[model samples]
Target: MGSGIPVWSDLTISDGLKYISGSYKIAMVYSGDSAPMLVLENKHSYSWDICISASEVSSGVAFYSYDDIAQAFSNYGVS
Candidate 1:
């Protein structure tokens, strides 16, 4: 909760990596978009939160995997 990035907030980590909360770091495959809690790059920084621009953003991790993220978005009518 003292990570400065707060918690349960949707953020864009980078381009291919995303952050999740559950007393641990979970990744590999998700179920939907879910708007990553602490979006970031695992190769760059896991504990620290980094900021980036929309056009500058590269490949990071999404809270979901493939259909998972897609599903979550669809469910929320995110299109």
Candidate 2:
């Protein structure tokens, strides 16, 4: 797969929040000793990919849309 982020046009933030809040299937990809990367797949045709630092893995942060992720980054002055 390409390293570029995936685009999800059909999913909304509310939908993502509900999926995370409810039971969902997740796939974990680990690289060396670093924290495992997490992914939540949409049964249809997309997935939400998250890469958390080792320290923040235990502190759950739910993201429901691209806007949500963008807002979070903006909060940290990542724009």
Best by lDDT: 2
- Deviating ranges (above 4 Å) for candidate 2: 1-16, 19-32, 47-79
Report the alpha-carbon TM-score of model 1 versus the true structure.
Answer: 0.25
Candidates' RMSD to native: 14.3, 11.0
Question: Lowest summed-lDDT stretch of 10 residues in model 2?
Answer: 1-10
Error of 1 at 61 (Å): 13
Predictions in order: lDDT:
0.36, 0.37
Model 1 whole-model lDDT (C-alpha atoms): 0.36
Backbone clashes under 3 angstroms, per model? 15, 0
Model 1 steric clash total: 15
Residues 1-79, model 1: lDDT tens digits: 3223334454344543244223333332223433334233345445443322222112443332344444444554543
Model 2, 1-79: lDDT tens digits are 2132333322233455443322333322333444443333435654433333322332343223344444544555544
lDDT computed for candidate 2 = 0.37
